[model samples]
Target: MKRQFKKHFSHNSELKCFFYRLHFHYDFYKKWGSTTPISLSFWVFTFHVRENICNLTLKGSVTVKIISVTRIIDDMGRIVLPSNARKALNLEEDYLIMRIDNKKHHIKFSSSGRGKEVPIDESGRIPISPDYMNKLGWETGTEIGLFMQGEEGVLQGNAPSCVICGSNQALLLVKKTHVCEDCIHTGTEASAEKWSAVLNDLFQEYKQYCEAAVTFTNTEDVHKARTKGRRLRTLIQFIGIKKEHPLYKCLKEAHDILGKVREDDVFIDAFDKEAENNQYSELYRKFIQKAEEEREEHRNELKQKLPHIIDDEFSARWKTFSQDELKDCVYKLDIETALQKYEKEFSERVIKYQKIKDKKSDKGLDSLHSVRKKAKKLRYIYNFLDLVQSIDYSRKSRQYKKIQKDYGDIIDLRDWINETGSLGEDIQDDHDDVKKVRKQLNQRLKRLVKQVEL
Candidate 1:
């Protein structure tokens, strides 16, 4: 009977008969006699029947070497390899090499002379060490499909999940790990806390700078204080503080006062450098003395007002606002929406400036200055978002920074020309040197205007 069966049964027909017999617990001929089809676990029964039939027909001959098993990853991220599988594969080495197939969503383990060694314990358990687990982004309680192919064991993760929260919904692959949007929101909350810390630190530094400016006679101190004040004000606006807020008003007043002193210092420095040339020596000296006197007057005004601007009451208000109001605002802020709003504002400003530039009117210098200020604010906001939200806007930030610098140079040249004109009337020598410098500045300004794009 066995010989007749082996001789007459086609390979596929014999397998079908074998499957029916296994599913119905009947002899192959009897099961084949019935026409009813029986369904079973396809993969499990197919592989099992193939292995059994091969062993029976071939008398323990090897046709195909394979094994399949399902294993649960324990808390320690360890899985037991059955003795039969290990023996069949001749997996006697203490270590195996692991390879990941991200495309197929499976991992393969084999014996190798190279690569990192994954250890198998004495009880036939393979412990996926911490490093390997992290590399695979697998966590405890993950089910893995284990199967053998030739001398290699393959593992497949059962389902994708959020690495942070184990959520299966809305999973996003990030650097070989899955993340869900809910966890991303939680991350944003954590970032808000970090931003609060950063804000507090900045406020403290600004106070320190204000103190240094008032206590010291150095012009650099005033410059540092004003810069810090501008940064704080930018942050304040980003946090959605109204301009009518006392905090904004206070900072703006102080910033404006310091700007006067800083401007005089800049003028004096320019004059000193120009005075090195004997042609403008007397005129430069006179202007330098006048700038020094004005700077002292502004400095005294700043010293009187600085202590009042960021006093204890203001500090208390800031702490209250940052902890209570600012925290909530920042946490609830949709970063995408904020970015869009700023971008829209910037686009509008660019359009306005472009129209003004096209008209070639001096009346638009104020509009040009507005565009420059808007670009600077946008650049600062981009940097702020990067630090607080981990968004990569560095390219946009760099772009806007260049815009700010270019416009700033034009404004500075314009101011210098105006100042030179004012001072040149007092110099009697036909004003040739002044005209030459002014002409050079005007030419450079025109070139810069031409190079600038909307």
Candidate 2:
């Protein structure tokens, strides 16, 4: 049997006999999205009104006391506000503002009448939209001609010099849009003349990922790895290479390395938990021993061929850029020079597998597999070209779409695998479904790799 209740929730103000209780917490505002239309306007008014009253009474001897109130919700979830608070706060029945910070886990109430109206240009930069600016008959290069003060104090809405760069000129109306010349000029030019910006941005992003990855390794930190992944994607996006390009193909390999490391870490953790819980801990121990041994075997193979890997590809990149050319960038200048030296070591993993792609030696093949896995860290850096150059948040972009398709499900499965490892082998029966899901995920991975390969 299915039952559904149709509850009505409208942006309505009803005349109430009691005052609603409100709480304020700063931490909520410090964090993520608490800025819904219902939330934003209410908070803005609540903050301003509180500040307004405080300022207005500051000069005088009068100390205004705003009463704290609470509404008690019964077991049935019905809230009754205290009658006294309603009368004290001048409660009138009109559509008023209610602020909710679900993130901070608090709620507040305010009357819309508390907000003072300030003049704004229709375009909305002066807190008015561009259409409104046109409606208001604002001309291009409008002078600093407006000012306003609420009970709190003065809040002049006048446009100032550009914020990004120090230019005394105000934003002008150009092509029915208000934008400063500095802001316009600061944007990346699409022309061939400014292509160096793209190249510089690519190298800088690559440096950032390398630094972050190194930091992750040193700290054994999950957060640093996540940051490294994000920056690596950004760098890959900036390079904007086709999937078929040799550089991008190499990047795909780098992606697999991080993916494998993350996957293996999760699997091992789960294996460790099973060992701890089961009476037959030997099985768990054996599983971990096998996994570790496999990892070591892979590592050894990479180490053996690493010298050649470094020498082959990295030397080419180094020679393409002079010592001075590499040294001048901010990312290059900030990170230790050893990161550059280490690239030679890591590239060996990437290049060695490519060299022996057809080798019949099973040991060589298996060893090469792990090296290829580690190579993904490099691809993660390389793939950022698409992210930084082409991805646009305002519109549907191909890079974002591909991420939703390629990485989204894999990340979920990876997290699940990590958590399952914590439960140990004693709970293996409980994780039959998880194991099935992982099998499905492996199939997905095969498809994703094939699509990129094609």
Candidate 3:
């Protein structure tokens, strides 16, 4: 009845005032006067614009028209409320932002406007216009709500207040959200001490390997030493130790020389195995002989190089280093933030590979080699930061590792194609087999390349 009388004032577009118009029994409307209008008392509604009908309840419903309002700011910089709006809202001279409920979605507005409009610039000068603040009842020291719903934010309800003071400066986030610098987050001594122990252990292992690698007589023994040097180099990079620190360049050079022997040793063994199994063994036998000669030369060079790398620069400088440098090595960033930063670096390799692929240039195959190397480094970077064992990568790490292996798989497939393709006319019986194997390898390689998508 109240709404039936209120229908005349409903959907007033001129004043941008929308109403929930309802019609009821004639006797009810007769009792209540025109000024006291009965309207739908709905706090919230899900309006589907496509449907004209209002789905009010699961039961039978009344006609409830929802009209959209468009308000204009008057030239005097004031919103003039029409008679219906003033009546509906019970208007007074002053209102609080917390009292108004437009009821679309929730947005948090705090006193200091944290995660809202910043008032000052880098020079500590106020950037907002004073007149604009005055228009919104915002004085210099007065606490106000600035509700924003746009591109930069889609925050709902309320966020946690500042972790230290329980103030609503719940803006800055690190390991935990709402932990402001004025309170909870600090450059931790406990964290630094923990990482120091990890660094000390790594430094000691690297020193032992540098000492022991020279005495190694076999491939497997040397490989162990090489792996130690590599993990140490990677650890230094992971912790972002200063490059200008004297050991950086010298240690990297030493690792490179150690890696050279491993690759040659791998190929020599592959050739010898090929010689033993091939139907036409004479050709592969000659290949194995040549490769054997190269391996001998590599071994001779490594024997001299490993000792010089250890004695000259690495051990001497490393021994004199203070524990303070290692203690200062851990990143201040929380584990989650640090992982995200590292992952961004890891994803950049995919971006680089994608650029090469998209170009459809002849050099795509050659460029993939560098991407493969970077993939391997990124895949193992987490292993180097073993101190942060609490961070779990159980699910995502498999996919991360699979990508690395996929890149390496292409490398292996290409080699197989090349080897089988080079068997020449003298090896007649193996010619057909070689051709078939090459075709298979080439096709498999093509399929594998297609799978390497970012």
Candidate 4:
């Protein structure tokens, strides 16, 4: 009777050669006899197979073991075989058979045979089937160990480690890269450093604007300085700087001084436009002259006060203060908490304003103004987070911008009426003209209020 034989190899640690193990089975009964000695050749070594085992002696000591390879599963659950392994297996075909052995707890890959055919991608990566991954409880960023068998490859699971710091504890898979919690905390510290640098640049910009305003270099410089001061104050508060901090107080004082100048500038510009009309030319002329005088007074105040506020000592102090405050500020946690708090407050304010509007009360204007300021605060906070941390809030910021513009127009007209009304009381002669201008502005304000949404 013929006997069947299956070939296997075992490593000889001392001799550095493979010893072939043969098994006689019933499946090879038609191909070989029970007593036949089979001749086999493998890589310059010749061997005669006996009953159940055979050992071939090499002419020289040769190492033939293929080194194991390690690879990380990418976000898409794909793994790449090393070039050497690919060459050794002669894996030239575009398709391979993948077999999962639950009993052996490993996956087997062969160039051909009966199994599920998986395509080798153009980049030479094989995507592990989702079903197989689910069965093995594997996820993206899992480490895999690959070793070559006779003409096949075996894949075994490995313990995952952080790609950034090689930490095995508290690993998080983010965008196919394993990151440990310690690295995340370090990243936050790095972010704080970045914010400190940005704040230093902002302080310098504020100083430049103040210089331009003080020198009267540009009429618009007053507005620019005020804006920069406001931004600085907002940033300082958000970064956990105390309101009593000298830097905050200095910025607030400068902001208030510039704000007065900006108000006069706005009034002067409005008067100049109104003076172009034949009907209100005399009234606007008088208003324009008074506004220009007040503007000069405010400008003089700014020239004196701003220089002292933004002098050399301010810069040096800001440099030291920003570094110290940012180091201790948990800005990441603060931003998230602030976002939630501001959003809730904004929503409540909107609802309250809506109720006030329903009553047709003049107080609705004040309530709406409160809502506008809340929106502005939310917008500023959103913008700050987006700029420093790359968190996206562009949509909310745009929505708030529209709200501020719509409400700001009404507020400006109301302020103009009050200013002219007060000036008319002082003059006592142009009271009728002031009343007419206030009437016209009231009509415009009503029209604008009608157009407002929420």
Better model by lDDT: candidate 3 vs candidate 4: 4
Model 1: per-residue lDDT, tens digit, 1-454?
Answer: 3443333333345444654443222242243324424222222132322223222323433334345566888988899887766776676678678766667756777776444577888888887767657766778887776766466667776545544445655444332334455654444444455578778888898888888888766768888888888888998887678899988998999899888888877788876887897565776686677567767898889889879887998899898887777756665454555668888888887788777734224656667877888888888878765554323567888988998987887776667677778766765774787687667767877777777667
Report residue 28 deviation for candidate 1 (angstroms). 67
Off by over 4 Å in 1: 1-189, 357-361, 420-444
Model 3: runs farther than 4 Å from truth? 1-187, 207-216, 242-244, 319-322, 331-338, 355-362, 394-396, 412-454
Q: What is the C-alpha lDDT profile of model 4 across 267-346, one tens digit per residue?
A: 88887987897597888888878878778898898888888888889887887787666666643234544567778888
Give the runs in model 2 whose Cα sits over 4 Å from its true position: 1-175, 178-186, 189-231, 302-454
Ranking by TM-score: 4, 1, 3, 2
For model 1 the TM-score comes to 0.56
For each candidate, C-alpha RMSD in Å? 24.5, 24.2, 20.9, 23.8
What TM-score does model 4 achieve against the real structure? 0.61
Q: Model 2: how far is 120 from its true place, Å?
A: 44
| Whole-model lDDT values for every prediction | 0.67, 0.36, 0.46, 0.67
Instruction: Report the poorest 10 consecutive residues by lDDT, candidate 3.
Output: 43-52
Task: Give per-residue lDDT, candidate 1, residue 90.
Answer: 70
Question: Whole-model lDDT, candidate 3?
Answer: 0.46
